[model samples]
Target: MSFSTNQARIRCTQLAPRIGDGPGNLAQIETELASAASDGIDLLVLPELATSGYSLTPSEARDAALPADSPVFARWQAILGEHTSAVIGFCEHGGEDPSGVLIYNSAVILTPGSAPTIYRKLHLWDTEKSIFTPGSDVPPVVDTPFGKLGTVICYDLEFPEMPRSLALRGADVIAVPTNWPYISRPENEHAPEVVHAMAAARASGVAIACCDRSGEERGTVWTEGTTVVGTDGWVTGEMAASGRYDAAVELAGDRRRISPRNDVFGDRRPEFYEL
Candidate 1:
């Protein structure tokens, strides 16, 4: 399943995932997955918490979350019977761990005819902090036929280290499944998340597929950020203001060199910088 090299087809989707509507949400995701495959998309990235929805209290989140080995894996396996890959987000029933926190917002990475690899969110957003635990493990860099893929949940992208670490681990693309909220920025501009994404992409020199869910949830409006940044650290697709679907992206090269003398990753002087 090697990538197409100069051209890789990918998509980001945004949806209004209803709280407690697992069946309905799963159905909607299936429809989108089918459509993306039909539209020649090689990889489809879905929004974070796509299964159980966000904005849950601790008890509610626990009730809604599916265990890591839930039947949803079987459904996705059936979905990917032959071709295509997808990154689906969900609330995970992390169970009890005396040493640390349980209950995580997770991203399930699925390839054709294989078990899914789960990546929990490392940075828990506002209300999320109360309900979910931060992921302790580093996100896996999955080696597919197409590319080296990695996944991160919503707020993880805000940390520059997250994507940079993935890139350093040989990930060609980082899929971000996010549920962003509107914020008061310098000029009430478009999503500042986009700006951060651009910086992350450039700094890490990896393409990014950001899937942000939309529609107001409990009076909180989603920032509608469905985007794909190219390897050159530039926004390639439209970040729809009203939640639109489908963005085709081409991922090329493992390196980002500004010129013959300066390479983005090669020029890094991490040794001198004190963290």
Candidate 2:
């Protein structure tokens, strides 16, 4: 289907990233970039730490971390098409900070004719605390020709405050690069990670796109949970474990009211309750 200028064509990739294999991982990212252009995708979101892989040892994380101006980023910038924007995950070096880990698990947003934007993971998972530092900055709601774009990493979406604030700040679409792993669940149900994403999308009246990886890293298996949720809380498109999934999402900033009398934001009673 053809997308109008107001509609955003988004794609997510589910692929296994080899741990500490920078060159191999970069090659995979290059292929995906070409694929995104071929698919005519407007926004492409890749899995968390996709360029460096997850489940790395502390030393491995340090070895994989790269400066913000690394040649790999320059390469990605060079290959991106005019209208396409991409979000990819990597380990970032924290130049002279004395507190916290010297590395951060971060995502870089690549826009056609602009400098890249960086977002560090605020909510650290399992062994990640030992390997990277937590971010303290508020994730930005970027303004682009395509839409009001926001982004958060895997665990960050679990907190309603994250998406709610982004939506309140005029973000109509949020991109998530996750590393969801297998956990105990019912025989035929979706992963909890996806459930959280859907709920966030519907509650905030925003489009949410996620990219999750496949295959095991350091004996830890991933859920391969790739999905896109519309503002209505229902999923648009997703592939099983490998491949690209596309969705034409409508991010209407003016459609927040449930009815003529009830506004999604106007009904808020934040003064009565406190965080």
Which candidate's TM-score is highest?
2
For each candidate, what is the lDDT? 0.80, 0.84
Candidate 2 achieves a global lDDT of: 0.84
lDDT of 1: 0.80
Ten-residue segment with the worst summed lDDT in candidate 1?
239-248
TM-score of 1: 0.91
TM-score of each: 0.91, 0.94
The residue-by-residue lDDT of candidate 2 on 141-220, one tens digit each, is 77766878899999998888998888889888899999998888997877998888888887778889988888888888
Per-residue lDDT over 71-138 for candidate 1, one digit per residue giving the tens place of the 0 to 100 score: 87778767655667889898898878774438889989988756788999988887787888888898
Cα TM-score of candidate 2: 0.94
In candidate 1, how many clashes are counted? 4
Model 2, residue 156: distance off in Å is 0.8
